[model samples]
Target: MAVTGGLIYRGIWKSSKRFGPFPKLAVAGILGFAVGKASYVGTCRNKFQQLGLEGGPGSGPWSRRGPSGRGHRSCHHVFEDCKKKDQVAPAGEA
Candidate 1:
């Protein structure tokens, strides 16, 4: 990751010398961050789909039991719900 970031920084620094150093650095940082985030999300979605967590036609066990009868849910929606559930205190413990 550090190597990738350094490459991005170097490329941006050389290509946009007209811009101030800080601006070039900022653009490279934002671009790197965005790329990293997108890669992570895509990987997670693919893994979930492979595991049948994102329910659909070939979704193993979850295909028949999805909240929607159609058996479909976005990876983002599923993960956000999981996060929300985890943050809440369970049952009478609270």
Candidate 2:
């Protein structure tokens, strides 16, 4: 990530003279991605707390399940929701 950021910064700096609005766009894209990742991590933490597994031994927001054994179930539900939407999309559209 640092490498990519460095490369982007270098490119922007090297072309600042001719790239008028492009530098702003590139910087915005990088910042947007950083913000999005941070937001997703926050959401995951909230989900962990809601599931009652905020800080279990091996079950964290990034864990597959809680130490109480509900980690997989929560992960499963997230994917299942997406699958359910996809399955219902055709009927809804028609």
Question: Number of the top candidate by TM-score?
Answer: 1
- Those runs of model 2 whose alpha carbons end farther than 4 Å from true positions after fitting are 1-15, 56-94
Cα TM-score of candidate 2: 0.33
Mark the 10 consecutive residues where model 1 has the least summed lDDT.
Answer: 67-76
Error of 1 at 43 (Å): 1.4
Q: How close is candidate 1 to the true structure, as a TM-score?
A: 0.37
lDDT of 1 by residue, 65-87 (tens): 44543334533365666556656
Model 1 alpha-carbon drift over 4 Å, by segment: 1-20, 55-66, 69-94
lDDT of 1 at 54: 59
Candidates' lDDT values, in order? 0.57, 0.59
Best by lDDT: 2
Alpha-carbon TM-score of each model against the true structure: 0.37, 0.33
Model 2 RMSD vs true structure:
15.4
